[model samples]
Target: MTKTRRAARTAHTSARTHRVLLAAQLGNSVGDGAFYVTSALYFSRVVGLSAAQIGAGLAVAWGIGSIAGVPLGHLADRRGPRRSAVLLALATSVAVASFLLIRSFVPFLLAAAVYATAQSGLAAARQALLAGLVEPGARVGTLARLQATLNAGLAVGAALGGLALSSGTRTAYFAVFALDALGFLVCALLLRGLPALPGTPAVPGEGPRLVVLRDRPYAVLTLLNALLLLRLPLLSLVLPLWIVGRTAAPGWTASALFVLNTGAVMLFQVRAARSVTGLPEATRVVGRSGLLMLASCAVFALTAAGLGPWPTVAFLVLGAVLQVVAEMWHSAGSWQIGLALAPADRIGQYQGFYGTGVPVARTLGPLLVTTLLIGWGVAGWLVLGGIFLAAGLATGPAVRWAERARSRAAAPVAGEPVKAY
Candidate 1:
């Protein structure tokens, strides 16, 4: 075969793999959308759980799941990411299905914890699989495409879930859960088609099993990323509350903001990621994203200026646009740096550790952000914006420190002559 033809065939295979992954993502994401929309109602109406029970159960479940991720990810590294991912995906399906039978608070909490742990593990395993399959140069771009697909799937799933919400019937809620369960099942089946990857063996004399914990610089990066992830709750909790209580804008404006953010991410995330090709560039992009987030916060604060309904809506829209754009930029940069900095042999554990940031932000952000943005009002907005700005600005130094540490670790020991293979 000619060299060009071989290269073409390789490219075609890669494209096919990427498509499969996207399909799997869309499958589960649709289920996620339905669950997100209807789960609370399902628990309350169908299972007779109180609001406090639901809240406390989920918080504990996710918190425990977040801490479990690092160890589970390490297992993925030892067992092979593809196999780990497929098994965890199946586990996730089972856990989601278990919710159908759960009635009391204890059963609900156990099921939720199982579901959260499987989800965290599956995410790490899938990330490891992506790194193994795709070329280094294309990882971030491929991640961008995945993000877009995720949003698209979520939107479609949300619409379906909304139908279930409208019906408010037990059968309708059960259908949503079934669909979510089926989605994960499909995801596992699709993953089975990919080429197998062997697990990476630990290096001789490696100090510990979970090295990611001991890596101070990576921990700093993870912390900063978690801080930026405050944006998650800012959108889901803070903005919606702000629109209703503080601004003169109609309740519908909150929904509109969600649509705008989702649509923009689905359409523009890949484009936004185009420039973040390296660690240095990714760090710079994060810094810039922080600035955009800060600007959006300032704009959001202005909504309380007692502007009329239309004007307040306009301000809200503008702030949302800015915030979503920053979200795209930050996501792209974080993906690049997170994937790039980890040691190749331990990517799964590192990615899992890094991923805890999402749960951390999700678990804590609503309370913290609400206290600041809603409690103190405009000054709170300024403070929140400053937090983003500082986190962004701090990334560069953290990355540099990580890079230097990596270099030192890889350097040949003194008085040990470098040997050619």
Candidate 2:
């Protein structure tokens, strides 16, 4: 074949891979949004579970799932990110189906475990696969677009699930299972046609056995991220319950989330994408964003005084504002740091380690907020704000530590710049 023809084929293939990836993400996130909107309510009201039980179970499930990312990441590296992602997607679909089929606690817990493991493996593979498909500069934009799309999917899914809940049937839950399954099958088919990751030799057994642990910068950053992510529990558990129990606005809770998501995707995402490019150091920006998140929590705490609906809305809105900003900052900064800071030979492992930050938060946030909710009232929620802010600030040192480690690791060898490719 002529050179021009070969280049055209490569371009076409790359586009196909990107399309498949986006589809997989869309499906997964849609199902995720739908499930989250309805699942807790179902678990509490229908499944007859307590708030503490539900909270503890989810934290355990997510944390366990997150812990699976590193080792599974090694397996993905051994075979291929595409294939691993495919298997994980399929497993996730199965897990969701299983959970819906049986409403018992043991069964539900089992399903959560299965989904957790599948998602962890999928997370590592997908990140590595995306990096392989795109060039360095383009990767950032690709990730941003992917996030924006998922958020859009999230909105659609949440709306559909909310509507389904309003209908007072379990149909939406089952539908989510089916949708998740289809996403996996679609991703598997699309991935089969793409090229393997760039910069990797076809040879096997070339990387370190525990290569992820060697990535000191990513490891340190992971700790900071764990601390910062403590904010999620407030949104996931505390605020939802608070909105429902504290105020008389019956449907106001969902409406607030709906508004929050809308504002995030439409107004903030573009600005986040543009501003994060060519950043000096991930540590500095991450630290500052953490500080702002703290400020936002303080703003949210003020909502306690006003019994009026608009006050709650205003407080929640302010919190959402900081959250969107923080989400953008965290997403861009973490990916860049993981891909750029880690050794080229061990990107997948680094990604896994980096991904753990959120899981750790998942474990702690709900438990912390739930306990405090019983004891402290709105003050407890405000304390959560303090936690998020403090977590962010405390992470500054860890971030700087990671940056230094990455710099040392990237030091010139034989007087030439490091071969990141």
Candidate 3:
């Protein structure tokens, strides 16, 4: 084939691949959004579980599930990401279906644990698959596009879930769960078409790969990333409580803030990620995200000053905007750095390790935000902002240290310096 023709063909194939992958992501995210909105309600009203039971069951289940990521990711690395992803998706579907039979706390906890483990496994495998599918340079941009698509799907699914909430019927809940399972099935089928790319084979004399855990710099990076993810609960849980108790804004303002955040993410996430093409740029983006988050916290704190209703609402909206902007940049920077720092052969394990931050943040963020940000009021906000600023400033140095660690690992014992592997 002519050079121009070959280039055109390759570009077309790449575009087609991206489209299919994005469609699968959108489908899965839509179901996840609906499930997220309705799961607690389903367990509470439909299953007739007490609030305390549901909370305890879910907490224990999630805690157990959080530990599954590393081993499952290692499994993906040892086998193949494509096959592992498909299996995990199927497992997730089964877990979601199991929710239909849940009655008492024991059954509920079991279903939740299964669901969480499958979800975590699926995430690790999917990320590994993406790494194998796309070129390194394009990974962040593709991830940003997928993130935007996910938000868009979630917005639509949240609306559907709201309809279910309004219906307040067991059938409505069942329908959402069923749809979630169907989405996972569809995602699995879509992934089935992807090419296989297994983990790198072990070297002759190399010991078993436990590198991710032993790498202190990477572990520190994961911890900081977890801290950055505190944005999740701050927006979802803390802000609404603050608005209702401390500010004059109406209850509906909380829904409006959510809509604003979702809309902003859908519209701006990809665009915001465009500049974060390299490690240095990604680190800078993370720092900038922290500054934005700090500004958001400050804006949020202003709403607590007994501002009038409309004024308080305006500030709340502004804070949501800033927070979502921070989210976009943080996500972009984190995706780039996480993928770039991981060894190609062990990307699955590293991704799984990095992903542990999500559960960590989800598990601990509520307590931290509720205790510090909400309990202490304005001082809490400043402290939280300071935390963001410090974490952001530290990201660049942390990344450099990780690079140096990699260099040291790659160096020969004969005092010969080697290029970073």
Cα lDDT computed for each candidate against the true fold: 0.92, 0.68, 0.86
Worst lDDT 10-window in candidate 1? 412-421
lDDT of 3 by residue, 295-405 (tens): 999999999998799998898888888889889899999999889998887788889888988987887788898998778999999889888888887899999999988
Q: Which regions of candidate 2 fall more than 4 Å away from where they truly are?
A: 1-16, 41-57, 170-172, 198-208, 243-254, 278-281, 307-312, 371-374, 377-400, 406-421
User: Considering TM-score, which of the candidate structures 1 and 3 is the better prediction for this target?
Assistant: 1
Worst 10 residues of 2 by lDDT: 412-421
lDDT of 1 by residue, 89-135 (tens): 99999999999999899999999999999999999999999999999
> How accurate locally is residue 358 in candidate 1, as Cα lDDT from 0 to 100?
94
lDDT of 2: 0.68
Against the true structure, candidate 1 has what lDDT? 0.92
In candidate 2, residue 161 scores what lDDT? 81
Taking all chains together, the TM-score of candidate 2 against the true structure is 0.82
Residue 262 in candidate 2 has what lDDT? 59
- Give lDDT tens digits, candidate 2, residues 1-421: 9999999998887777678777767867777777778888777766777877777777778878888888777667666776777777778777776765765677777778788878877887788778777876667667877888788877777887877688766665567656656665665666665676543333343334556676554565677677677766666566667667654334466466656755586556655755555435444556567766766666655556665887677667777777768767766766666676555555666677778777777777666767776357767756765666665565556556766665655544443433221
Per-model RMSD to reference: 3.0, 4.5, 2.6
TM-scores of the models, in the order given:
0.97, 0.82, 0.95
Error of 2 at 234 (Å): 2.7
**Clashing residue pairs found in predicted model 3:** none
Q: What's the C-alpha lDDT at position 24 in model 1?
A: 94
